[model samples]
Target: MYPSSLFQALLLSATLVPNVFAQSSTTTDPTQRAELALSALQIWYNAGSGLWNTCGWWNSANVMTMVSNLAKHDSGNAQLVNLATRIFANTIVQAPAKNPQPGVESQSATKRSNGNETYDLFNSTGKESGYYKMIGEDAEPITIFPKDWDKAEYIDVKNLPIMQPKEQVTTVAASNPNDWLDGFYDDDLWWALGWIGAYDVTKDTQYLTLAEGIFKAVTKAWPTACGNGGIWWSWQKDYMNAIANELFLSTAAHLANRVQDSDKAFYVDWAKRELDWFTNSGMINERGTINDGLTNDCKNNNRTTWSYNQGVILGGLVELNKASPDATYLPLAARIAKAAISELSDSDGVMHDACGPLCGGDASQFKGIFARNLQILHDAAPDAAYVKSIQANAGSIWDNNRDEGNMLSINWAGPFIAPANASTHSSSMDALVAAISVN
Candidate 1:
């Protein structure tokens, strides 16, 4: 972790300094912009956890992937390569410590079964000595029940027993210490892709093996009930969301290309199977963009058309096209990319999420996913529009959406917001790296 005092000093200097990049004309260069964005991002890095602070489990994978992409894009820069190498090594060692099983006690009271008894913990009124609802730091409600009802013991809310329902316990055992598997299949998929990207840039067999292990672990959650296809979003198998399935397809296709020919057919087959299911899954609406996930009846939920939802599938299709040499994959990816740019971009052609200005933690990471994946598709089949969109967004992020400290905001187009953290910075870093790649 960086020293808090020094970090604050840097932020203070960022505010006082009139354009920190003004000393050099290279400031306008895409590569230099990416380097500056990276420096700002590292300020939030927690070396002990092998993860960036202020972001959730999956976002760290994207952060790692972004760094790896920069390493690849600026391979001639030995300093950048060395920084990427150190980050890869440190994260592999420290990230596992952050992974843990989601315990039963963390489950919400409403999710638990209690003989049809409804506990409106958020609104229930009680006497001074009776049970009361207390809000947790995450804004979730906690019901503090009296420990000894017979004794009429008036225990404080902090000392009282938390109400829990009777249900089967959820336990997750890691395959190995290095395994970064979590309760969410999507989280594992993100790390798998991150490690694969690392392996691509570094040619480290260990990273490849780690990614393979993650892919294997996630395959166990492939649901047969969802018309005998698609990976579940989590171990609970409650929702088969777009991100999880998109990552599954991308991981499988990427592995197929990287693995040896004898083992190649297995991954290719899985990739093709996943693509078939996802294309027919009804999640992709007529607009060529995807919704969140399916409803209970396996119909389109028609949820928000998130940028990442459009973005991740582009990468998956690009990889599958490479692995299987399908003529249609690239065109399909192009259609989705075009639709996303048309739907998500503002009058100025800068991308923004439906819940913009404050897209919260997760959605803040969405637009960058689109930017990078669109670059992938553009690399496969060159498009002037894709390049224009990327350059425009990158320009906006640097000129309009960034703070004096070189930190990026969730909004790519406009005034900078306060409290920009790892998710927002890394997501914008994706745009910078993509711009460099396209150039």
Candidate 2:
């Protein structure tokens, strides 16, 4: 059960004055710090929308995963479990309508009218024409357009072509009533992993089944053109990125471990196939850290070594190791984790992204992903360095990176910046939760 009085006090104090709570300082205990961080995150929760404010669709998925991690770590806390259950239930019902708000859809339609092709792959004609473009927004919903349509004439914003609706699966009460799918494949995979994490904590078949549904949805995007392997990042098929493929591998391997049927082998094969392709795909650079994605020629783009690109693969490899028990999987994950720590952290061992100071919403969520997955890998194979790094980062987040409201900044190293949001709070929550687990 929740410590209602203490929680209410913290909320009240956060509401009253910013510096008061900061002056008093937060608890040094990792578990208590995690609990406080979770409470701070709730300030952004829009119960009506079933999503947090100031973050995108995919960021909410990471938020859910973060909460589920805390609930899993603190299983005895009935409040945490109940909170997870409520979020899982509400988000599936409310997010579809609220996420791609009417304005976002309008903006996407407007972009389409300007000869910016935005096609939904779920639509057969849209897939064939391949004239789609994603709007310049984070995880914006895809609007399908008819083939051979008049590019010159303004599109009827009111009558945009809707993508094919997802088939309703009866077993899961948390089924998305909207039957809506986003434009980005990585967005869907994040939700898949979120539901999987929720299932891990709650043992709820609905969540697991929902994850399976999401996984099945993404499986449709496995490209026949990209050398007959790897999932594309979006319906646009612009380029194959590390994050999407990492998500693909992780989701498959996770399902393989959770599902008990003939489908298990199918997932196992897919995970193995993805791993085989990913290992040879040239995304993992010479430093053993992953780059952003492949080039148009299917080579490593050698982009910024984003913390998330390094993080998700750790959890994926751990899951793959669980599914197949490969001798190389865990060690490979450890090496990458070590490399990421070496390359991404500062002299004081605090994690920092390449796009710091103002990493924006998406990048704000990146470091915590690295931290959370590092804990996953550590759970499989205990590493002293991983534990030390996790602890140090968690310490800095509370000591140097948080405000009076306990909201965290994008820079985990120090000097809490103003205007923190769900993305940063939940990202830091990932580190706090990881610290609790390893400590």
Candidate 3:
């Protein structure tokens, strides 16, 4: 169970922590800081490819979404626009919406060359495409389905799933804690949203088409398994996470607004269906915040209230209302946004997640998604509190979170520690870039 009070939660956290570090200090600004931060981030870019080469392909997708958002908000930032253009042109080798390579390189080169090795395999979902893994930093490639013959999810490389044009899966399964949803449904959700973000920036119908196709594939996979509504986290189809469903709803609604005239109803219907099922799915707890997901038994497993869970549904609801002009959507979105600000924030109002100091490859991406959506809420509703919270966190991101190269190493309400990496930096970039756009 979660702590009933913020004070109780903080006390539990402090007592549980093994050690604490002093806070870092730096000066702050929103727009200027975002620009300064990007200058530092560009160091991670690979000149060999226009991609932000320092991170895994998934994180690089997030980086692209962030760059596009930055360009959209800060129209005067010519460099940001140029970066987006370059990435779109040169990143053909990266796909769902990418080009396939045809060279004779080592497995290491192939995986990294594909730029699709975050979870480490191309066919992450068993129902998805591609069929290989790159082990460790050497980027060694191997087939994904050979742990044991008895496993149901395992399949030989030669028998890979026949994928539709939009059903591109990247990343690999892991054996560490087990590789159940490495190419998680949520991952496709992220990729779909990233493609949408790219579409929003470029206005190229190809990006929109790619997103539409991905959405089509995702909707086709909506399961009758546990409760007959939510999409499974992966092809393994054991547990369903809240984030994936939220992304599903958001993607559907977002696409409904973006697609060509005839296709609008298809996506809009999906958006409504998903939102209806999700709200009643028992994931939303009594405090009005979302739980992580359902247990194998399909009951509310009562996981932690992640900032992203609270964050994502807000955007989904807002978009749902925008697409259909329903009275329910915006108010629901506003409620979640209000709950997130009240519950998930620290005394200083910067967002906080319990999974830290190192929230691993995935959780690193959460708060920025939160910030980006919060900006969305502010945009639709024009709340003073929302804008101020965004600006404060955005500015403080520069002040407290900055490390050696201005890469924000986790802990949004921070005494920042840990070395910076592409995931941490690029995710935080979303929040800072959002600050510029909120007003």
- Go through the candidates in order and give the clash count of each: 0, 1, 6
Best by lDDT: 1
lDDT of 3 by residue, 1-439 (tens): 1112324323322331122122113334466566656655654554233345335545566677787777678766554555454455344332322211111011121121222211211222223334223222321112242233111221111122221122222322111111112344565566667767766766766666766766665664475355567776654445677877998999899998998879889889998989888888888888788888887667887877778888888888888888899888888887788887888787888887766666766567778888888888888888888887887777667777877545687877677867776678877888888887664
**If ranked by TM-score, best first, what sequence of candidates would result?**
2, 1, 3
Steric clash count of candidate 1: 0
Per-candidate Cα lDDT values, in order, are 0.74, 0.74, 0.63
Q: Please provide TM-scores, in order, for all candidate models, with all chains considered together.
A: 0.80, 0.80, 0.73
Question: Tens-digit lDDT track for model 1 on 169-263?
Answer: 12212235235765567778889999888888777777887888888877766653456688766555556678889999999999999988898
What is the lDDT ranking, best to worst?
Answer: 1, 2, 3
CA displacement after TM-score superposition, residue 108 of candidate 3 (Å): 30
Q: Please list the residue runs of candidate 3 whose C-alpha ends up more than 4 Å from where it truly belongs after superposition.
A: 1-29, 47-54, 95-183
Provide the lowest-lDDT 10-residue window in model 3: 101-110
lDDT-superior candidate, 1 or 2:
1
lDDT of 2 by residue, 134-171 (tens): 42243322333335321222211111212112221222
